[model samples]
Every structure is written in structure tokens, then in C-alpha cells.
Target: MNIDSIKNYPTGSSVKHKRKITNALEYRQESAELCDKKSVNRGYSGSFTGIGINRAAANDFKNLGNTFTDKIFRSKKFQNIVEIFENKTVVASTLVALIVAGVARPLTNIAMAGDKDKEDSMYAAAHAISSAVIGFVISSIVMAPFDKAFRKIKDDPKKYLQGLEELLDVKEIGKRKLEKSKPYKKISKVAQMIPDTLVLGVPKAMLTIALIPPILKYVFHLEKGKKKGAAPQAAQSQNLDVNNNAVKNNPAFSMIKGGVK
Candidate 1:
């Protein structure tokens, strides 16, 4: 008989069907046995594996949450402005030096030395050393107020972050009720800028008045210039453009333009 005719035969009388069923049953039993052996070797049952994974993940999450809440949010309050300023200044200074040195490297390669081999090498070495010293000094001066500002923010993370959030109009903190609280109320605009004023003024006035030839020339490379004010001109030009556009689009600018002219 053909394969199709064999399928039409009754199962109880069919030897081929009986043999296939027996082989399928044996394969299923072998698969189950192998699975059990592998599970035992790995020391895992389905129930225990899931529970162990969930418990470990939960513990790790808990530790991370606790560290953020305890160490960052609550423990450090803004108290010592001077200490905060100094520490921040040091970090800022270090960062400034690193940035300046990176920028000065290419400049050194170009402008550092003459092409006579030995003389060029000596000049290059001297230039690098001098550049390093300049970088450190510039960094120290630049970082003072920056560090103070950092400390101010670090000391009161929420308040500082809130103010920035407000200034930027960030949506996450925009509607938070905590922004109207006592800590946020205590800081003023003038107080916020105090560190900057002091940092700049003290060094500047000292450099301008105390030094004979002006240390600012060599140290910071100070420049002098005056910018002409342009507020009125900018406002008038913007108004004129708006008027012209409104006349072009809405037919209302004609009357307004005529009156203004």
C-alpha cells in the first residue's frame, strides 16, 4: 500500500502506526530524563532559580536607593562657604590646568623652536616647561570662583538644582512644591554672585594697583576695549521687521507703519 492508504488503515490493526507511536513515546521519555539530569548537575530547580534571581536584584536596588537618599540628599548641608569655596577652587584649578595644557601642546609644536637640531630641542623643552607653569597659574586663577560656585551648588543640591531647573524651565521640577520652601527662600541673587565678584575683583584690583609694570600683562594677557551700546537700534530694527511682515500678511501694518513714519 502507498503512504496515503496506510494512514487510512485503522490504528489497532496497523503495525507501522504502532511502531511510530512507540518510538515517539521513547523519544519523549529520553528528553525528560536528560532535562532532569542537566538540572541536577547545575544545582537548579525551576522554582529556586527564579526566587534567587528576584531576591538578589531586589537587594541591589535597595542598596543603590539608600546610598542616594542618605549620602547625597540629607548628610551634606551648605554650612561652611569658605571651606566649600577652597575645595572647589582646588578641583577647578586642576581642571583648568589640564584644559590649558591640552590646548597649548599644538601651539608649542608650531611656535616653540628654531629648526637647528640641538637649539630647536632645547627651545622646545623650555617652551613646554614655561607653558606648563602658565597653565597651572591660569587654572588656579580661573578655578577660584568656579570652585566656590560648585561648593554652593554641592552644599545644597536640591536648592541649586531647583534654581537651575527654574531658570531653564525644565519640566520635571517646574511644578514641584518643594521649590517654595524655607531653604530655597533664604538665598538671594546678590548672595549667588558674591563669590564671583570677590574672586575677580580682588585679583584684578591687586594686579592693576599693586604691580609696578602690571603682572596681568604676563600672567593673564589682559586686553582693553569698549563695546558701543546697541539696544535701541536692535529694538527699532526688530519692530520695523515685524511691522513690514504684519503689513505683508494681515493688512494692519499699513496704518501702523504710516503712523510711525
Candidate 2:
């Protein structure tokens, strides 16, 4: 279809169309990688704990993860995260594993080592207690910021939803023009429901827990698509090939083609 046709195509229809060629696996992988980049670039809380000096600074560093998570997911950014994770479960899973391994395990061990009755080793015990207290305090402080970010994601559900809409809308338009056979329509309808399922199903709720980084990543790709121009071109040489094949088999045109030479 020509660019104008695609542009004029109903948004609803375009979405349904694009859904066909759009590979879920690729989208998921791309989104997952993008999400990781954002998380790292934005500064996970652990990255801020430099040198461990200045208890207050360390405390801020400790909570940096929450802050970063809260900020990205609370805004349109959350959609990007969701899109990425939709395809890449490993990214999310690995992150959770790392958090528990790196943060929780050490804290629990230290806290247990600081038993109050260890008088003979009171200094070591006291050090453990002090360490545990600082860790807890820092954690609590960081959690506040993280919670704020999470609230932001909840506050704006449309960012990623809009992205999905744009994608789905374009696909619908493409399908109507390119694949209008009755059988194709049935398949298209089923395909259209996948995103709806994703948005409405268990993943929707889990987004809050996992921080919706994958969705946010997909949104980023959408933005990039817009920047690169998502609008399809009709005048491009490829269209001629498409049109030629389409009309070549017509009964009236069949003789006309073979008679040309």
C-alpha cells in the first residue's frame, strides 16, 4: 500500500496488520536488552555505593535501585520495560535473583552474626549489629524513593498502552489493505487479541512487581520507529512488485502480459 493509504488507514486496522510480521520473539529480546540498558544507564541503587564512606551517601546509594525503578516505570517509560520483558523473561528473572543474592543474603548473614549475648566477642558482635542497622536504615530510605517511582508507573498506564495502540492500529490498517481474504481475517482477529490478553492478563498486575521495564523498552523502540518513519511508502519500487504480482494473474491482464513481447 502507498504511504498515504497506510496513513489514512484507520488506526484500529493498522494495528491489526502490523501484528502479523512483527515477531514476538524479536520484540521481546530487543525490549529486554533495551530495558537492561535503561536500568543500568539510569543507575541501579547498588551502583551508587562507592567506597562505603559517608553513611548518608551510602544510604542514598543503597536505595538508588528503588529510585531508578520508580522514575522509569512511573512515567511512559514503564511501557518500554513491559515490552522488553514481554519477550525476555530471563532479564527480569536474573535481576530478581541478583537482588536476593547480592543484597538479601549478605544482610541476613550479618544480622544473624550479631547476636546480643556474644559478650566475649562483643566488639565483633557490635560491628555486625551496627552494619545490620545501617543496612536496614539505608534500605528503608531507598524504598521510599522506589515506592514513589512505582506510583509513577501506576499513575500513567497510557504511555505503553498508547504505544501498543499505535503498533496495533498500524497493523490493522496494513492487514485490511494487504490481506483481506476471508480466512486471513479470522487469523488476524485472533492475533489482535494477543496484546489485549497481555495488557489485561496476569502480566498486567505483575508489571508493578517487576517494575514494567520491558514495556518501557518497547515504547522506546516505537519512538525510534516514529523517528525513523513508521509510515510505509507506496511509491517505493517494492510496491510496483507487489502490485505487478497482484494484477498479473488477472484473466484480462494475463493475455496482455504475454502479448507484450
Candidate 3:
């Protein structure tokens, strides 16, 4: 072979090898760029998917809460309770008073005492009983007529609401319309509460305080007494027993006892 031909052959072979290496490097760089773009697209898609899921969960929770509330509001027991509170205002007020005065107050007093004793407990109980009795009795007697009138108004709004048309802001009122009126409902509820909360509250408390001492002395036998002659005491005890027996045997007393039971 010729020397010039051999040298040219080696140079051409080297140039061909360099071009192949450059092509390979370019292909690798293009593949890496495509991978990066795909990764970014996947990341964006994943974030969107997460956001959609969260929004769906939130909407589901809101719907569930609304459905639960609607069920509670439409329940029969809830309606009955509301009916009783509206119709038996005096009785409802008395029950609240009894719970606060007869049950909660005595328990609170005993719990708050630093050094508890029988005398302290007895005194608290006596006050509680007296307050409960006085509040029940007075509220029943005082609010009966008002409750009856309100019932009459509820039953016959067309007849009863004629006098208070201006105050109620409706020219024509019927039972159905009055029941549906939000403003009238609110006003009537407040009016029903006024006798117990405003008119009778302070007076009942004062009367209860006044009667506590007498209740403790006579009912609970809390006071100390001087000894009496045995013969007179025996006679008094006999008469008291006879009176109690007679009262117990009375037809009216028997009927009352049965009714209470």
C-alpha cells in the first residue's frame, strides 16, 4: 500500500468516530429534557387531583351537616318539646324554678361549703324547699289567667287579635297566619316569659326568704322547744293523730292522692 493512502485512511476513521460520539451525547441530552418536562406535568396533575379531592370532601361534609340539622329540626320529639314550652308557659317556668331553687341551689351550697355539717345541709334544704313551694304556688296562681287568655288568643286569633291589630302590624290575622308569623312568635314567647322573669322573680324570692324560718321550725322541727306537761302533750298528740286520720279518710283527700300518684 502507499504511505499517503494509509495516513488519510486513519484520519477519516477518527473523524467518523468523533461524529458518532457527538450524536450520542445530543440524544442523551434530549432524553433528559423530555424526562424533566414529563415530571413537571405529572407534578401539576397530582396537585390538581389533590385539590379536587379536598373540595369534594368539604362539600360532602357540608351536605351531611345540613341533612343532620334538618332531621333534628323536623323531629317529632323536638316539636313536642317546643309545643309544651309554648302552651304551658307557667308550668315550664315552674319546672325551671324548681330545678334551680330546689335542686341546683342546695347542691351548690353544700358543694361550696368549706366545712360541711348536718345543720348547714338542713338549713340549705329547708330554704330550697320553701323557695320551690312558694315559686310554684305563686306562679301557678298569678299566671293562670294570663295563660288562659293566651290560649284563647292562640285558638281564635281572628276574634282576639282584632284589638291589637296595630301593635301586631298585620291588618288581618288568623290562627294559621299568626302561627306562621316569625315576629308574632318571638313577641308572644317574650310576653309569656315576662310574668315569671320580671313580675314574680324578686317578689317570689323575698317571700321564700321570709317563709324559710317558719318552714324550718314547723315542718322540719329544727327549733328547740321547752318541755311541756306530759298530760297536756299526750292530749295534744292524741288530737293531732285523730285529725290526721280523719283527713286521710276524706273522699277529697283520697281523690287528690290518687290524682297526684
Name the candidate that leads on lDDT.
Answer: 3
Tens digit of lDDT per residue, candidate 1, span 81-175?
33444455443443444444434542554465445333333332333333444344544666557666755654665665664655434443332
Across 117-196, the per-residue lDDT of candidate 2 in tens digits comes to: 23213222222232333333333343445444433433453442334434344433332432444543453444333432
What is the per-residue lDDT of model 3 for residues 162-198, given as tens digits with 9 covering 90 to 100?
7665667666687765765777888998888788778
Candidate 3 residue 156 C-alpha distance from true site, Å? 0.2
Better TM-score candidate (1, 2) = 1
Question: By TM-score, how accurate is candidate 2?
Answer: 0.19
Residue pairs clashing in model 1 are none
For all predicted structures, in order, the TM-scores are 0.27, 0.19, 0.49
Worst ten in a row by lDDT for model 2 = 230-239
> Candidate 3 — which residues are off by over 4 angstroms?
1-82, 111-118, 163-171, 223-261
How much lDDT does each candidate structure score? 0.41, 0.38, 0.59
Shift in Å, residue 26, candidate 1: 47
**Considering lDDT, where higher is better, how would the candidates rank from best to worst?**
3, 1, 2
